[model samples]
Target chain A: MPEQPDQSEQPDQSEQPDQSEQPDQSEQPNAAVEPGPGHRFAPDTEWRRVSPKYLVVEVIGSIITTAIIVAALLVAFSLWGLWWTPWAAGAVALIAVVAIAFEPRRVRSIGYRLREDDLLFRRGIMFQRQVAVPYGRMQLVDITRGPVARALGLADLKFVTAAAATAVTVPGIPEAEADRLRDELVALAESRRAGL
Target chain B: MSGAAPAKPAVDLADGEWHRLHPASPLLRGGLVFIAIAGFVIANLRERVVEFFLVIFAPGQLDDGFGEWSDENDWGRDPIGGIVANNLVGWALLAVLLVVVLVIVGFWLSWRMHTFRVTPEAVEVRSGILFRSHRSARLDRIQGINITRPVFARLFGAAKLEVQVAGQSGNMQLSYLGSSLTDGLRRDILRLASGARATTQSPAPAVALPSVAAGETLAEPLPGLAQPAGPAAAPGTGPATIGSRAGAIVGQRVDEFLAPELDPELAPPESVVHIPVGRIVGSTLLGGAALWMLALAGIVIVGVVSRQLWMLFTFVPAAIGIVSYFWSRITKSLRYSIAGTPDGVRVGYGLLSTANHTLPPGRIHAVEATQWVFWRPFGWWSVRINVAGQSVTSGAEAAQRTLVLPVGTAGDVQRVIALLLPEAAEGGPVAAQIGSGLTGRAGLDGDRFSITPKRGAWLHPFSWRRIGWAASDGIALLRRGSLVRRLVLVPLARMQSVALSAGPLRRGLGLAELRLHTVTGPVVPTLPIIEREAGDALFTHLAGEAVERANDDRSQHWGREAADA
Candidate 1:
């Protein structure tokens, strides 16, 4: 199967996505025009970032879970009273701290844009992903609030479509925004779905 | 839209009455299963029962190797005969009676608990004795309706109806109904779903209770006639009415013997491609079954040489299991035929129990036609379509449902292509291009398709020349496979999303794999190890085309009208 590339042609690398610190300006205009008429983002379209309090909620939640694991390990090791138990717990606590500390930046990376006919959500730092859910295809638009999220007055807006792969979740939005977006999405979906 | 109205009661159905299953349904379903088990048990007990008979009735015959070797010296043992003639025979008879009585009770209870009702807009089934579960399927969302009759069920004039619906969940099954009413019910359901009246002033077709027994509804139209008759006065002959009912029941029996062919709307398709019986048998013998047989033979030889008779027992059941598999596949696809209808495609096949599947518009997500290395010489290929709900169900049951064509000629492949996406075959330039790339000879040198770079061939050594992709105005085609050549066609409008990725090896080879995500189905289209530059251009092009196609179809009310009609 190992066949060399034909020597007559040069291997084309022009199509490679520019991974420079700044994306190519020429590509942005083309990407923006590709979605067609009604292609323009809504005049009031704003990329709403998640609540900062969500970071506190995530960190506290992770620390609490880690504490339980540490406590369980300590209880199990009490009989032997190993000298390294405290050190190991300390190491785990440090790891948990480093992991939880990334929550704020990760939360900042998540944003959702409400367009005229669809909703766009982009998330992740290292592995970026953006999904657009057309209003007519929205089977369900739900808001879910876990205990920690509820305490922090934050909720996740989950959009479900016919193909499960197209489902997107805009996490850690303020409770008020969640209600407003959900109502608007439902109304839009109803009108569009009626035509279908 | 949120929650102004209170929750509606679940089971109301357009003023229709709940109908119990036919009287023979219980005997046909639960009782038959018990009977099969009881038959196996009785067959195993036959030798012992025969010995007991000989020892009791004829002591002379007991010397003809009838007894154990230890018992030879006492061949004339009279004490055992007394035991056999007394309590043993009575107890055995009582046990058999109890078992039969239990089976009858089980059947009766299950049948008593289950009932169904058909409304103009939906079909509702309420089953389960203790749990009391109810399921309702909306008529408009119903994707396909399958009516199957097993040989045993046919003898008693019963059939099973499965209603396939949209989405990834929810399928309703009404099993063991009298064969006489199933066709009428099937046609009525399809008509109602297509926005036609099912229960208008006509009671003769769907609700006909044997024309002779319940002649009151005789004024209604006959089913499968495509017209409702005007009410007319009947001759006032009492005996004649009874005679017709008896005749109708007998006619139903004959109809069961020849099922799919008898019902016109759901008839054996007029234009169809039938797989030859010899090809099916030959393919099975030459395919995986050959390897399985060799393995079985090795086990048998090992058992014989080791004098471990018990070892043979293990492999014997495994061998039989393999044999039954081939038997089932052959039976399920013996006379496979697929035909196109105005609304959708219809498939029918089977040896013992025949299944007829009618996939309505907008049901199929993707289509795959494949040719295995062994069957390539004979010009045989199998076609599979992915309907939304059928994939995650039981694998064995899915086999009967998703197979549009188990095996057929080149003509069948084109027919299947037309059936799967009729819109593509209507001389749409891009669609024709994609179609040719799909059904034409598998090669990288096609004019319409872009072949993978030769360097990328390292990733797919066996099938390098076959790896390529072609895009039409509304759809994209991805070709792959070496031994089992496959072409996957995904409508751009139907795609959920797309992805491009390269692993460690792919990066070194300057290649990436492109995945076009549709719903979960039998065929997942992919182009692997293509030039990275080509992958990026294709990705952007497909993404733009998908958006445009979705909007065009939606605005023109094309795809949506068919699904929501």
Candidate 2:
């Protein structure tokens, strides 16, 4: 676990969200297109910055894994005539380096968007996935920050649904945005409460 | 608290149910972590010479210890086998290590796989770090939430949630959620479920049977309802402590007799319907006697084959048989009570496996009761319900829900019918089907016979004799039969799936049997509409177009109170 200060310590950190900081999709002209009858703009916006600590965690994990493999292989080679030990060690070391180098980029790419009725999260490199959690079925939203995420001024927002096993996670999102989204979900959930 | 003035007071179904973190989620994580660590430990120790010998050469390695240990405690191996085993020890350790890693990784993934978000409207199932999959179940569509905290999970405080759906096997679930989240999800979904009927139109008024509240409804206590101010029962007056000396004695003795293993009773305090100790002891003794006899016979066989005059040799099988018997009996030791009120019914069974399953009057597909030939003399009939989306087995030591009434006569069955399902007992599709089938002596005759055929009908006066099934004779044409002469019924409501079955042989004869799936029983884990599944499926398909078309069957009035048993 990262031993670092959480985002709540930020001097400018805001909890009570102002509506002025609305989604800016200025890059897409089609975004302005009106909803015909049943259609609504996809509820969420594009990705935003993720917690910076994710980079360090990913790199460290990959490096430790690499070191273990290299040490084991060297021992095996010396003792049990392990074949191609040097080459395997080299290949694994190269992977660890690549993973470490790209860690920062992957961390930056993690972000979530809030749509009118669904929440979407976008992550991954070559194969990016977009998840949508519908509003009507929304149960509760929790904003949690692990030690590493806490150091990076980021939080993970989770959307829980009633289905026994479906929870969507928007990980490494900006703490401020995470709180705003949590508020929005709570408001909408309360508003949608069935009539007494 | 008056019923009338509160015009739709609470969000009916919405208000009653709640969700909290499954209490054991963290324990589950810890368990997973332990298993992973255990794997690592195994990996670390796997390559060592002495441990390697322990694994393969040791008798304890085999699941049943046949290849590993000598029956005569002669564990020595040939000189060549020992040396070869030593030479390959390093490779074996490496392989075991690799296996351990894979197992650890798989468990972590599985733990990750079962993560969930439960709400009032629906439950969400999500898994996979790379190639993720997600499934959600609407509250109304969910028959019941079957939860099983496996032995490992129990240690970790984690449990799996499986929802039994209408006309489906294993609808969906989440795993290893902390208890709080699981409870929260259940509550939220049940809340949303309570709102389901309201969604189609206006919500139906939820009937909260007062008696069913704690047990049947699985009351969430509004988060602030403290424990009953004081134990109303005097300090010494509690019926019997489950883990107490007596309970443990009962648990252990039952375990030795082929009973289902006794996990402690898990249903919330309210749902506990206690049975007298005498009944438990009596049934167990009877079952245990039968098993002991079987073990004796096995010993005789073993002795005859070996020609050895050994008293100690027979001990193993006899002990094993006793253990197996205890496990079976403990698992299926049947005891239950139906807490009924005007609103609904809460059926709790098995002191240890007590699960209080409540069905709103609206969600019931059907109810059925049948008596095996042995039960006829004593009038012991078992009742089952066709619940839409009801859970079959959730891995909770007990099954989700089955209302086995107190062993009663036909008259008592009638009263229970009146209390639990007044309309069905008075004559709905359930009552009519049961009534007509019982008195009508109707059956479809084909070229086959049942397990207890009409010929064995009188063999033992106390046995559950087959009623009127004669494969060749057309006299009981009202009923239906094939090789499996099972009877069934389907309410127009809980009809989600329907199909027809005709085996290769049956197809040649140009005959088809309609199979209707109902929610009931852990055995085969289903309720099939033996004779009418096909026709029902086809008609229901069109009825589904309108959705509300079949619900009209609820009002179908028929007088079935006196329908033949």
Candidate 3:
């Protein structure tokens, strides 16, 4: 778990992007393209992956939801005197186990990068995406934590921009980290959008 | 709040005085409900009038329906006409007087409850009898000001001022002000907004005063109509100077404003573009609103000829309602004209209730130019842009507001395109090529872009070859349509997100549709059913282009001062 960087030093970082791997001449300052998983904007840039506790939350939620559905199905099967009822429960348990095993890897694929003037977040495995939101265009930044996430000390940071399609959500970061990132992004957005 | 207080001009509105709406406000706002009620009453009266005719002309028919009952009841036997003939007309007149009194009392009460106040920062309006509610819009966020005069309000020398702001769910409407006052207020606000920006840059002189030519034949000023004209209105209450020296000078030099005085005549207009009546009607008919009108007309005609007079009670009102609905829609855009000013794009249109829209630069999120299939022969097209914060007011009004041009020649399209997207049009392509690219018509310049495969024609039986897309250095253009040709131009900087989707059938044909998400407006921002490889390339290419140009300074600020800011 990487700590969210303090953005008070942004002015320094903005002036020193040239010192970080020649500033990638092929790429635009606003474009954040990732060919595959495990990508960052600069060589020194750190990619913040969601907390592993997110998987625990996911597994618990999955088990509880699956148990409720299976219990209901079991009641119906037994009340109707269906002998293969136990087999149905066993199948559901199997599916839940498989889902729990895959949860961590899926969570690992989601990562976000904070750049000098924009933020980039990439998610999905089969149909991968990388979206960049400029600080000047950001309208709102909201942080929300569900019961499961709250218990696990995690929150979701959502970046809202003028264009609905470009809004990005980075989920399962530690709560404190989420707050710090939100504050920094808000400040940056305010300064960048001053003239507007 | 008393009506006795003299009306204050909008110029002195900065003192934060809470002023009620022009006394005639209720007559315009609540008058609609009253008119509807009156319509019902007249409908009832019309039915009685028809019955009276039947009683007089066809006594035998009347006897079959109500004569037996009339004979059984003495009071009913006389009817109202017989009573009047018997010299009981005074009683009838008293009853009518009582009803009129009740209506007047209603209008008065509604009028008394509504009030509005204007401050330098925001405009606040409050109205509610039981459940009081207040709404206000900050001056900084306001996108435009529209002055509207409905047919009835016009007769009373009143107009409605609608303050449109970015992101607010509803427009802040102040109704029933004098027409000239509303115009003066619009100029005042725009000037103020522009003046505020000038503090940070060089001051540009205000353009020539809005020409009265457009409003002359249309009853420019019903001056005498405003019985209580404000005290300060005699000399025009709006700020007359380009830059007032009333404010305290801070760090910047006062002399800097005096330098670089460009020719005001050479400067582009603050606002001007009008949609002619022919185009307004043409575009509406072409968009299928005409079909609805035709179907309604047929029903009304058939019902009347078949002696189903009851249909007048039913379909005639409905027909009139529909007709008025479309009539209002067409007329609302009748004289559509947009002017480019430092504050924003000031749009004015409408025959009876003209609307003036001030679209500040940077407020517009996306721009798209489209031509329907029917419009192809005439080489006419309509342009619409998406701005932040407008609540989608049904599809029709949304289409209306976003219209940069209701109907325009190809040359007009190019001019508007250039005005809206100077960066994209700068030395990129000729106006004709842009027009052809927009219409998806392959004459000489359309082939400059990539066209869909001949197999893609299977998807668009009506327009296969015409479906194509081209990417310029700063913008991406997608043209699609057969009967209704549409050209969507996405400024790379404004592209929010890009997506590609393919149904099973499209996948089978190795084709997919690419969609670029833009702000809410009339344009759909899509490249429908192109080759799968092309879709992928477009998606990736646009994403990159959008990012590259994300910081492109396209604000409408002018001069070296504008550059510094």
Interface RMSD, candidate 3?
11.1
User: Can you write out model 3's per-residue Cα lDDT over B254-363, one digit (the tens) per residue?
Assistant: 22122111112222533334456887777777665667777777877888799887775776576677678767768776656665655555665666554556665545
Chain B TM-score, model 2, reads 0.48
Best by lDDT: 1
lDDT per prediction?
0.66, 0.44, 0.62
Q: Look at candidate 3 and tell me the lDDT of residue B156.
A: 58
Q: Write the per-residue lDDT of candidate 1 for residues B1-565, one digit (tens) a residue.
A: 1121122222122334676777788777676776788789658757666777777688777664433434334535543334454446677668778977876776777788888887765898888877898899987678788878888878777788888887556888888776656665665566556543422325423333232122212212222121211112235556455555555555556555764533454454465576778978877766656788888889899999999989998886888898998898888877566776644577777867877787765566677777777777877777777666665546777765776877777667766777677656755654555444544534524446676677866778777767888876576878788777887878776666666666667877878777776667677778876787888787667755665566554322222244455
**Candidates ranked by DockQ, best first?**
3, 1, 2
Q: Which stretches of candidate 2 lie over 4 Å from their true place?
A: A1-196, B1-115, B118-121, B148-160, B167-170, B176-187, B196-328, B331-368, B373-379, B385-422, B425-565
Worst 10 residues of 1 chain A by lDDT: A8-17
Higher-ranked by DockQ: 1 or 2: 1
lDDT by residue for model 3 over A95-171, one digit each (tens)? 88888787788788888876554566777653455565656567889999889999999998998766666657888
lDDT of 2 by residue, B410-466 (tens): 454555555544444544444433444432332333312222333222322222232
